[model samples]
Target: MSAKFLQILLIAMAATFSGCRNNSGDAHEGESHEGHNHEAEAKSEAKADPHAGHNHGEAPKFQYTAYSNSHELFAEADAFIAGKKAAILSHFSILPGFKAVEEGKITAILTVNGQESRAELSAPTRKGIYLFEITPSTAGKGSLRFVISEKGGNTESGTGEKGELRKRGNYEVIVSEVTVFADDHAPYHALQPEPSAVNTTVFTKEQSWKIDFATALPAQEPFGEIIKTSALVTSSQEGEAIVSAKSAGIVIFSAGVVTEGMSVSAGQTIASISGGMADNNPAIRFEEARNNFEKASADFERAKLLSADNIISQKEFTDTKNRYDNAKSVYDNLRGNFSRSGQSVKSPLGGFIRQLFVSNGAYVEAGTPLMVVSQSRKLTLTASLPQRYLPVLATVREASIKANSQSPALSLGELKGRVLSYGKAANSDNFLIPFTMQIENNGSFIPGSFVEVYLKGLSGTNVITVPVKALMEEQGLFYVWVQITPELFEKREVKVGRNDGRSAEILSGLQATERVVTAGAVQIKLAQATGTLDAHSGHVH
Candidate 1:
């Protein structure tokens, strides 16, 4: 790659790795290993040789090259094996032109053990060259021949010596790069937090609004509309009355049918009997029962009077009264149902009858829905709240609402509401708590109309604050990396409070003085995972 292109690629890499390199876990010092010298030694060795051939006989069987500095080429055997994985450190561009050469092109050659194997030097680019490996390939004095040509440069001969037994010199390729703390302006450390203030962030019950945030978080964003849950609502009466059959025969509503949805009203045709109801004697039986009840009633009243006058025993009076009540109750029930089947039917309350289960012609055994009537209609609004907000509202209390139909745009111009609410217990996998509110429809809201509910009397002032993006929650624990210096950052665990689904309240572990990572925490996080990012060096994160 061209130097400029490589530099460009590095910038992009720094940005990508910035997130991962540091955010994973480790703290970095940006320290690198020391460099070694090879250039001077090479030139000095060349000077000593003075163009005169080294006595093939005198050049040590094991000799070295430092690039001429410290002549670092080490050797042990006759030949060494190395793969095409070669690092070429040249003074000029040799990569592009060399790569242009034919594949497996021979750029270098080697002579070893009376058998010579050509080591090809290849340039993958004009600025670089890779030798199809030779040295270190075999275990001994690795050997090779140099036949490389450079762009705008002359083809040259590589200097190697013929050795006897101590299998000598191996050529060393040298590369150099400065290893120091990169400048804050070195195209990487821009926007790092300054280091003059305390290396901490602070906030309290006041000045929260002024706390420096890493970014903006808004609440106007749209959320999914809440779906409604269906329910049945009813009111109980002041009295409990029993409606039953007159005899042992089947008990059915005067109307033959029964079911939840079927509609019925007073005086409506319901059900009738086949045998007893078909004859006039069912009425006869009811009259007989009524006559017996009248006699019992009169006898019981007389017994009560005699007991009061001490003319009868208390036990006798009590027995007479019990018998009279039972007889009268039986008589009344028969009288009320005699004209119909032994079945006893009653009128249902009234309203816009919603459902009708039994049809006009379907037969029902007994206690079936002949029909039904509703007394009134009502409206309800249902919605979900984040679990954190569940505790702020009360059960069965008024709440303010804005409905499109009734108050177009809801102009109450006055604060009003009580909280009657129910919702899920906490923020589990499903973070929403479901709730419903009963609203008396004033010919305004419909059952399915959309509405917005506003919780009233909810108020708060200043509190600890932080940017939403800076907070990272893992395993329910929250943390943020605070930029502790122009070149360092410290990962800090924090306590979070009141997340209005936007900025969060920092209850602890963070403050206003330290700046936290806002936009690239993920990059820093991934880098930390792969051990590439230095958490200690303040940069992108």
Candidate 2:
């Protein structure tokens, strides 16, 4: 073949090779496009997964606590995952009453990157627990607020108008520092660590509602120095009276029975003095006065006749008239007071008979003491303190008195009382300084009864205190039940300082913000003895 023919053949072969390369590239491109479609389908299937974030494990529970004027909200929610459904559980409690919220509407609003989403529950699943589910729209940092609509929806006029159902009140609890993670693979840490279960007691809301249960935060207040002592309850000067005999005779009780503590009214006849064989007898005096009056009348009549005949001087007639007048007056006075039963003795004031000085049918002389009456509306507390505490007595500002060991201490301020005086020198009998306080009786104080007294001094310092009832004595140490959450309480040993009957000072083992069980502590103690405390009550699940 010629050289030109060979060149043409080479070119044809090169052109064919180039066409083959192009066909191979087209086939490879088709495979690549198909692989891309497969990847796209895989991604779409992953997005449709119902349990994408939850596949690893259950989400960590996030808890938030908030308070409103009407209610307290404790909320728990499963950590958020973007484009995934999560569960939220809310516990609502009424405030000031601390009862479970039986009925209400709760709404959870979630906001992320200026986008907002909400989930609402018409009513609580349980009495106070409202459980619901929410889905986060996007993955980023977000915030949540729980809006609660109290039961008994109010109207525009706040009077429950027909067909106008506005919520009675909407209480909002904001959850801060909330995050929506892209996936569940990342480590999560809760905002607040869960409280430990050790030394904790579970007092359920149901149990608390069934009985008298109450809680109060430790009060930061000025606490005064305390001086503890015993006191005697006695009737005040204005609250007591002495009943005396108006005449000398035998004592006779009225129809109504007279005894100690028997109530009497002012001007009510309680007893009578009858004539006896004694010299001061009313019957004897009456007879004497009658005889003397007869003699005086006889003399006065004879003198009057003589004076009419001008047989007597003017002075002698005047003397005779005066004697007759005196005799008549004496006779009339004896007759007025001397009855068949003799003289009646009436109570000078309204009160109860405190002491009977004489017995019925007993002989008594004139102006003799019979009985003692007490109004009992007011009382005086007299206490004796050691001479060493004289400085404290001078600084006393107020006092608290307890009638008995089982009774609670009564504050002088609350009883409308005041310190009357403090003794300047020690008494000879007890070698102690005397102190007196006047208090309104309130029917609890009994005269002559011994009581516990706590004199509060003026020197005070700011400290935290709780009601005296909050303390429970174990062996000798003082313990208090501190509330960790709404239902969880831990028995904490507190260092007790001065206590003024009603309140106790906490030197340690307590915080001002923490709450304590003021009432029903004994019930908890009994429950503790019975092992009724649930150890796992702190777990949200």
Candidate 3:
């Protein structure tokens, strides 16, 4: 009872002084009185001291997070008290893209003691934020909600896709429960504030909307065994044609310079053979054939009439007709083809020039190969697989192909592709077995270019997977950004199983419903280096 009694008395006196200072400004002028309840004040101080982590200058704040088909709402408001004014801060963000809502009407409704009060804001003080002030007339447990409406009905419900949400009208966003106390001196007046997450990175809607940012939910998809290998893109079996010289002569390209990869059409003259003063000179040969055809025609006409009138023998008419037919055949063949130049070399098929066998002005013999034109509409993707894969080659039914290292892998099925053939055994020259797939070009693939291919088997199992772009690497460990809230993202380390050059199978460390950053993941990783941000930075209360 010696030192302890003195310490207790001093602490009680100090608490009394602090309470008097807090209520000094609330009293009327000259209305001071003496009989105060020190025990009640001490009990209130003890309850409030445990929540000193959060600022409680005047009143406590309550936070609620909610989501709608169209938008996400995160709201914070002052604790409800009878006849006291409350300030509410609401943040709105659009879904799918998670961009801030630039324009809208946000209504905050508070229902307490069988009565309702509302505060409305037509526009935001800042983008994505709306502040509301309301007063509660009575105090009790109540429900609070927000109704959002926008003009022109342009707001999307989900993904902005058709049938995802109501084509027109406003919607409500559901949030956490609401509690109203009788007064500030209630039993549950104060509580410890939530600690900020260390690993959660904040990517603001303003920052995300400006860049190429997007997110997608992880999904369980059918994934098959992948045999990764290199492939060669080549023309299909009937997609290539070789143009040959019909007659031997000096080659002259038609009009402009002809080069490899130049587009050509069937019967289109790509070059001409000039028989300058030679035996194959089409100019001289054409004239001779014309003269011979004129003589043969006159003789055949007279022979036909004479044989019918019994003026000539049947054998003579037959001989005349044969000569006429032979002369006409040569004339007709050279008629359209012959000119000042020897003969026109025409492409047999419409395609790009894959190869030019002979240069301009080069002499070539009859039937000499001139060029190769490929109708690249259909292409063959050939992959060389080791002998061990031969056993599973027959089970392979589809392929995923990347035209180049920078391109995303395209599905063979989507390209109207199918397995053409596969070698049962490895060839003697090279020990690797060849596997070929026929895929429609879709104007995306180039012939003779090497590509990365993933040969997929017929059997598969459903597994969680994400696009390969979503995964980031750190010291050989793969990680992806998983969005916990609209703006808060947590980096999760995952064990990658199989990658088909497009989507990767996540063996662990992820949930199917969690949305992951499919694009602009690097931006978030860079933000992590900068440091974490207070998610509630712009709060008004």
RMSD of 2: 14.5
C-alpha lDDT (0 to 100) for residue 405 of candidate 3:
79
Off by over 4 Å in 1: 1-295, 298-318, 330-350, 361-373, 377-379, 384-418, 426-432, 447-457, 460-541
The ten-residue window of minimal lDDT in model 1 covers 70-79
lDDT of 3 by residue, 136-210 (tens): 878777778788887667544455411265443576776646777786766244544553475679886557766
Task: Evaluate model 2: give its lDDT.
Answer: 0.81
TM-scores for the candidates: 0.29, 0.66, 0.69
Query: Per-residue lDDT of 387-495 in model 1, one digit per residue for the tens?
Result: 6555554432433455542453221122222224576574476677756555444454443346655433234344566656778889999988675431234567999
Candidate 2 lDDT, tens digit per residue, 1-541? 6999999999999999999999988877735554467678777877898545545455577766666555666666787888888887777766555567787788889999988879998888877778778889898887888887776555332221122333467767677657887877552543356798777787765576566776878988877779989999999999899988878788989855788989889888888899776666777777788899999999999999999999999899999999999999998887765655677777889998999999888989889999999997888999988888888788897888898898889899878899999999989987988899999988788899999999998755689999999999989999999987756789999999999998999999999999899878888777777785663354345
Candidate 3 Cα misplacement greater than 4 A, ranges: 1-196, 276-285, 288-333, 349-351, 413-416, 440-444, 538-541
Order of candidates by TM-score, top first? Answer: 3, 2, 1
Global lDDT of each model? Answer: 0.43, 0.81, 0.81
